[model samples]
Target: MAAAARLAVAGHRVTVYERTRTYGGAVGRLERDGFAFDTGPGLLHLPAVYRDLFVKTGKEPLERCVGLTQVDPASRHVFADGTAVSLPNASRAGIVSALDTALGGGAGERWGAFLNRARDAWDRSRRPLLEEPLPADVRPFARDPYPALRTGLLRRPAVTLADVGRRELRDPRLAALLESHALAYGFDPATAPAAAAVLPYMEQTFGSWYVSGGIRALADAVYERCRARKVEFVFGTAVTGVLVEDGRAVGVELDDRETVEADHVVAGAPLPALYREQVLEWESTDEWPRHQQAVRTGRVTVCLALRGAREAGAVHRTVVHSTDREDELDSLARGRLSERPTVVVLRPDDERLRPDGDHESVTVTATVAAGGAWASGNLWGAAGGPAVEAFADRMVEAAAAAVPGLRERLLWRVVRTPADTFRETGVFQVPGPALAGAGGSLLPAANPAPPGGLYFAGGWSHPGGGLAHAGMSGALVAGLIVEGAGFRGSQ
Candidate 1:
């Protein structure tokens, strides 16, 4: 959306072709007969990133377009013994006090110390790593790595996420609570990079948030802003191929066989599809193997919408630990779902999603597996299939156990596995795009092409995933397009 807005503003005649029936690639809402569901990403953090985009587009202020409400005690962590720990985001001192009261003295201190390290890491990389583009050459990282390490950016660079957690926060329970956030990156924490610790720290520091009506509001706002800028949206259109002439992107060929010409093209879809399908013509001499082998992809997310008139009381997000924390690492590494799954229920403050007296809103989730269980049609509802119903029953059982009266709230439900997600969002293993690779962080390599009119955007590009970041990436792509869009006829 940002890229389109920028291109439109620069008078480049931008046309956005979204394969999905509606816009907002993976972070939009679905409304079906009075039931509203968040089809993709539920949590909204980093509001500033979005505000910046709105500002660039000269749209109404972000607050006016999207209601920004922060989630205090971002999520409630429930234990089998009925003990609950809620991590508050308002202030670290309050969080420390609560943890100290709930657990003990050192638990709070240990958490504080860990966050202090996170603060240091955030400061160091705030500009150099997170905000700036990383050089393509790995020498800086290969050399002294401490500049990145001392701040607790990413430890044990070559080791898996589990190794880092085991070494730092040894308590298995603490580790599970800490590592549980790894699903955000679509990897098991055990296998993910240790530096991933930053995710939780950031979330805890800057509470989770929601837009006023729904997250869909964010997408709608972007779309409206784009329209104001005269950006044309070719909805329900699929770009099947990139029309490359002389080894550069010139336009796109839709599935309908119509070619849309432009000075350059930017895609928000995955890169692998772009490359493997030859969307961008590759020079015979370019090194491309590392991109193919190392840029990994994430797994599926199953979303459920249940009919309910009652809320889950106080528990919003629950990570059920089947056993002591130590066992979680072993269990996850073995490719088994945790005995107690991590469930996040968004019973919002707004009364509308839930009829005034009834509770509503949806549960968006990510579940891991050993192999192809999710891929099997039996797990998701297929034609005349009982698998989806059975799976829904199991999820309801878990929810009922965690929150009283959850079963009685039964309504219509929809389940989306990774396979389903690929079909609905069209974000699966696309070519050319890879997850961020430089040091396991989202740092961009030098432009694959130098000083050309070409540009890139979307989660498939650098700073992959997340709706806000994806929007920001689009904005970045638009800026690049502005700089090189034949203004001076360099192309």
Candidate 2:
């Protein structure tokens, strides 16, 4: 929608071909028995990306299209030792104080010092790594941009995020907190570069936000804005292949054998899907970027609809850390379910999500391996297999720490596996955070394909995943389309 809106405002006749009958690819809403749930991305961060898109596309800004509220005390974390801390939104001092009160006296100081270093990483990488296009010579960014700290008697400096947590934070709980930031995005902290610290820094500095109804509301607003800008949308029409002529994409061929001709094609489909559908073919396997070939993770979310009213003072988001971080990461890396996986529980106080003030809507999510047994079609339905049900039960149990009387809430639940996600969005492999080493092995494929006039957008392309990054991808694609290859970035 962002790309379409921008192209339309640029005086180009834009037409969006959507396979599903929805505007948002993964961003969707599930309504059942008068309760609403956001199926993807419960929280929004780095909202300025969208704000800039709205301002550049039209006279009305993003605030006019959708209602956004900053989530205060951004999230509460519950460790395995039963220690809990509620972090304030965008307040370094408040977070330090909260950690001090909850964990110990020096715990907050350690975390504060870590954040200070993380701020340096964010400052160094924000523009080159995010706002602008991936440079042809990415070796500068392939090297870790995080600043190193001096420690007495330590010959070797800490390079990985896990190393920083163990050496600097010292406390197991603090280490878990640092690792959770990477884990939440489906990155293995042990292997993740020290630059991964930017994840927590970005969240803590910019703060987390939620649309009034749900994230789907933001998607709806983007869709409506595109419509207002006169962008044509063809829903329920699947693109089968890209029309290539003279080694360049001229248009797309749909499932119905209808060819939609265009000068350029902006493909939001997953790269794997494009290859599978024969839309894109390389001369050799080596042509594909190594980073784009990295393993991708998926999510398993369970939505609960309760009959009773939400308790007062309930935190909007709570992360229950795993008992064994190493085991969890190892299991995820091996494409297996973790025995004690980290779970994120969300309970929005908004009345729009429930039938009335008496009802409560909660969503519990855990990261899982993509395209495994868990992603099988049979496990997507309400009556999942025994193993799937057992995993859901475990996730619910973990989330019980946030919601009192969770099992007794007396309402049914909906389980959405990676298969369902793949069916809806066409991207079975959930993109993870771009890593900071191995010659750009962490990043996604470049936006511009080898074939001229063929461009890629969304999480599967450059700049990597997350709602904010996806939005930025749309902006980048638009810039490339309007200004050609010389396009630097959004002005």
Candidate 3:
């Protein structure tokens, strides 16, 4: 939508072809027989990214689309020992104090020192790297992307997140908390890039927030802005191919074989899917062959949406760790889903987001199996059906144990496996591959695929995933197209 808005503002006749009926794609909300659930992402930390979109379109301010507030106690971590710590969203001193109280002797001071270092790294990298326009080539001398680390006074922490934390802070439990948060990004702190520690650092610096009605309102606002600018929207239509002629994307062909012609096309799907299915008759082009095989995808939650409206009490968030975390991950890597799963719950009452007066919708997610084991299931019978039902039961049991009296609150529940997700949104599923790709960092550059009038925006592109990065990718693709390199000519 950002891409469409930017193009429409520039007076280009823009049209978006969405494979799903909903507009937000992966960030969309799901409604099944009166129950509503945010299908994909729920965390809303960076509001400025979306705000920039509205500002660029000359639309109403973002606050009008959805009110925003930083969440108090950004996240609550419950341990197996009945110890729970709810870290205030932005209180550095407070968090350190709490950890010290919970863990004992010198831990608080150590946490404070570590956070201070993270703050320094965040300041050094925030503007000069993240918010800046990604240069076409970051491979020159003082400007070399590799050496920019030194130029910017940023030292590459030559250790994994787990390694760094252990080396600096000698507390195993504290290391677990820090590592667990990083794990949320689908990375194992043992091998995850040290920079990933910056995630919690930033969330604490700015805070964890939620938009007024819901996060999807941000997507809706973008859609409305595009519509006002006359950008055509074709939902529920899947693009089967990119019509490429003379190495330039001319338009697209739908699954129904209906072709829509345009001088420029921007795709927001996984790049691997685009390469595998789109770009018709492109054997003569370099864009679809070699570079197309570059990406490796990762997988996330097995989400469940409860039917009807009923408030999920006290437990705003819960994480259930399985006895076999490593083994489960290994199974997922081989395309097998785990029967025993870890769960994460973002209860409906987190921000009083439930329907009024003890009534609200709830969302439950279990980090179960992904890949082939999950992909082979029957999606329609998900709610009470064996596979999904068993997982939901385990999650419910775990959650109920954490927050007493949760089981009797009975309401309908629908479990969504990766197989179910692929059917719903067509997001390719890989068991345990890297979300950041094998390259480790999301440095910006021209499309690795054959360029020539073709471009992409979304989690599949550079600076991947999360709502902020995806929105920025859309804006970047729009800017690149408007500059006239004509995709194929960029390399």
Candidate 4:
């Protein structure tokens, strides 16, 4: 949708072909018996990205299209040892005080100092890593951008996120807190660079927000904005292949044996799917970069419908940390389910999500191996398939610490596994954080492929996954298409 809007606004005729009947690829809504749940992301961060899109495209701003509410006490953390802390949104002092009260004496001071270092990293890499198109020569960014502190001849300077946590935080709970930020996005802190510390820093500096309705409303607004800009959308239509001739993409061929020719193509579909199904016999080895084939992770979400109303002053988001971090990462690396997984519980107080004020809607999510052993058959209904259910049960049990009497809520539940995500989006694995390594393997494929006239967007492309990154991907592709290879970035 972002690509479509930008292209249309640039005075180019734009058309979007969607395989699903509805718009919003990953951000979707689930409605059952008057209960509404956001099937994808539950919270919104770095909303400035979408705000910029609306300002550039139309007369009205994003706020006019979708009602956004900042989630105060942004999120609560429940440690395995049963320590709970509610962190106020965008308030470093409040967070420090809260941590001190909940955990120990110096925990707050340690975290505050760490955030200062993280801020430096964010300032250094913000433009190059995010707003701008990746430079052709990525060797400059291959090294860590995070500023190192002199610790008086300590063993070795921290490099990865795990090292930073253990060396600086010096408390298990605080270390868990830092690592949880990476784990929530399916990145192993042990391998992810300390530069990734920008994740928590971004959230704390800016705030976390939610739509008045589910997050699907944000998608609805984006789709509506595209439509208003005269972008045409064809639903339930699948493109059979990219019509490539003489080493250039001429257009696309639809399933109905009809071909539409164009000067350029911007593909939002997964790159792997494009190669395997949409592009025929096009054996250009360099067309798809080797780093694009790196393994990606996935997510499993369980939605709960409760009969009771959400209590006032309740935490909108709660992260139940996993007891065993090593085992969790190992399980994901081996394509299996972790015995003890970190669970994120979301409880929105909005009335639109439930039948009435008397009812409540809750969502529990965990990162898992994409297309794990559970993907062979319909795990949702297979008689012998108790693994998924058992995992879901454990997630719920862990979440009980956040939501009181969770099991006794006595309501029906719906589970969406990684297999379900693959079926819906055709992307077998959910894109994880770009690893920090020598050859820029940490980043996604560049916006422009080899040669001319072919571009890529969405999570599979540059800047990687998550709601904000996906939007940036679209903007990057549009910039490349509109301004040609000479384009630098949005700036």
| Each prediction's RMSD to truth | 5.2, 2.3, 5.8, 2.5
- Reference-based TM-score, model 2: 0.95
lDDT by residue for model 2 over 1-491, one digit each (tens)?
87888989999999999988878988888999999999999999999988998998888888988889999879999999999999999899999999999998999999999999998888888876677778777777678878767555855767788888888889999999999888778777777788889999999999999889999999988988899899999999999888889999999899999998998899887777776556677666566553355555678899999888898888999999998787788876776778888999999999899999888999999987665322343444446567787888889989999999988984999988887777886655677645566456788877888688988888778788889998888888889989988889854
For each candidate, what TM-score against the reference?
A: 0.82, 0.95, 0.80, 0.94
TM-score of 4: 0.94
Better of 2 and 3 by lDDT: 2
**Deviation in Å, model 2, residue 165 alpha carbon:** 1.3
- Pairs of residues clashing in candidate 3: 242-279, 287-450, 337-369, 451-487, 451-488, 452-487, 452-488, 453-486, 453-487, 453-488
Displacement of residue 88 (Cα, Å) in model 1 is: 1.3
Candidate 3: stretches off by over 4 Å: 120-129, 132-158, 279-315, 320-342, 350-356, 372-388, 430-449, 484-491
Inter-residue clash pairs, candidate 4: 434-442, 435-442
Candidate 4 stretches greater than 4 Å from native? 149-154, 278-287, 290-295, 371-384, 433-439
| Candidate 3: tens digits of C-alpha lDDT, residues 11-98 | 7998888877778777667665444667666667677777788888885877777777776667776654556676777898888878
- The prediction achieving the highest lDDT against the true structure is 2
RMSD score of candidate 2 (Å): 2.3
lDDT assessment of candidate 4 = 0.82
Candidate 3 or 1, higher TM-score = 1
Candidate 2, residue 457: Cα displacement in angstroms equals 0.7
lDDT of 3 at 447: 35
Encode model 1's per-residue lDDT on 64-137: one tens digit a residue.
88778877667766554556687776578877777777766667776666677656645544443333333456
